[model samples]
Target: MYCNQPPEKPGNKKELLEKITNMARANSLWVTAYGTGCGAIELRPLHTSRFDMERFGIAMRPTPRQADVLIISGYLATKTLKRVIRVYEQMQDPKYIVALGSCTINGGMYFDSYNTLNVLDKYLPVDVYVMGCMPRPEAIIDGFSLLMQKIKDGRAQGWKHYKENLDYYRENQKKIITDWDLPDYNW
Candidate 1:
């Protein structure tokens, strides 16, 4: 009825298929490596042979459109927060955000800066928070694992939350990004 087809009723087959799909998505997570702030430096080793993120099926993609996971690391100034919102909007659905460091959660040392954002969650939905002054690669991997498990269990629904609460998020974003020029929908 909504599209050209009739509305399908809920059933066991649908649930089973959803579970299978979730498992597949959980394994094939593609991270968007956005260089937000000083925290970006700590993420360098994750791709090297020492960490080898691919072993866990997590690889960094160059663009937001191709990435499934966005890692917000370091202190986010208002300028960076604007770009982050734009990138987050560009990413396709079923996306997830992994916030790294105490800086991202509560602004860390940059808490007093008028230009830096104190709380990232006020602007975007964070699926996982890897807490540290600068979390170690092992801690980041552990965070990724937690995100994967959440994805597998079909609990990582930040994308849906973002879409549903678009107005609330937009207000928070606009408050920080005073010179808003981007369109409401990038796509």
Candidate 2:
């Protein structure tokens, strides 16, 4: 249920500049290479000739600080969830989260598990949920395209929402993460 239309053009110079900035951000997406579960396997083929994600301006980043998107692939264990939150917070503004697989949406096969999170949106605002047990590279690409469209339409504001509603998100995160030891986001 995300907006797909390009934003309405404004008359002012600031608005015009913002439109251009949004377009640029939409086109260039640097995804962090952090996969939490079995879905990580499918992500590898995206770089191959058949998939070639780079053609769409999607590249893998080594660190969260340099990445624009964090693709949480598969079920998130409680231990890994803590690190994921840390990495996610380190990313700069306009960041996005792509939940790959049914696990992220509803915990998939691990829905009843004690350690896995039942819903990802409670802790992190997910921009796109690439459905399937392990979504194919094509689906992942489609998800990326959708995310890009969201960026262009100014609908991908998960990071901003996180910042504004930090306490609400933190409460959800703390409920699942028992051994919380991460530093507060002061930026």
Candidate 3:
């Protein structure tokens, strides 16, 4: 969707153009750098000047509420998996979750581990899956570029669908963890 502006006055073309540009920039697309596992370490280069993800108009956001994309970097333990759901819930509409590593895709090295969840999709809907034990910086950049294209084409699902599946997601989350499951250390 194009950026909307209030009615333009006779003398405000320059200001209007500036506003439109900024609005387009703001709405173009934004991603939240949600690094849940070891693959997160590789995100460093993607954000650096060398790879320079910003040049493609993909800016990293600090909070999920304002973000349009959430990058789940690597493995998800029961503990961290629960938090990922919470963060995903907080994000605004039109959000996408990209699973970064094979771990996130299918548990990678933790395929048989009890603490790790085998597949992120079992808990959340993943839009893009990048396959690698620890994907190189270029792969992350490539994934971001592909995701941006999908966003521009209006192919990405908005958060409303996620909201609709809230109960389903909650049920899946229940398979992971709860405060009652924690061990008591009191003496």
lDDT top scorer: 2
By lDDT, is 1 or 2 better?
Answer: 2
How would you encode candidate 3's per-residue C-alpha lDDT over 1-187 as one tens digit per residue?
1112223333555766655544463346677777899988998887788888777777888998788778888998888976787777677655788888999877899999989888887688787888898999899877866666665554555344445565576578776776634222210
Considering TM-score, where higher is better, how would the candidates rank from best to worst? 2, 1, 3
The segments of candidate 1 whose C-alpha lies over 4 angstroms from its true place after superposition are: 1-12
Worst 10 residues of 3 by lDDT: 1-10
lDDT of each: 0.86, 0.87, 0.72
Q: All candidates' TM-scores?
A: 0.91, 0.91, 0.77
lDDT-sorted candidate list, best first: 2, 1, 3
Once fitted onto the true fold, the runs of candidate 2 whose alpha carbons sit more than 4 angstroms away are: 1-12
Clashes of 2: 0
> What local lDDT does model 1 show for residue 71?
91
Model 3 spans with C-alpha error above 4 angstroms: 1-27, 180-187
Model 2: what TM-score?
A: 0.91
Q: Please, what are the lDDT tens digits per residue for candidate 2 over residues 84-182?
A: 998898887779999999999998999999889989999999999999989998999999999999999988988777776777889999988878888
lDDT of 1 at 180: 91
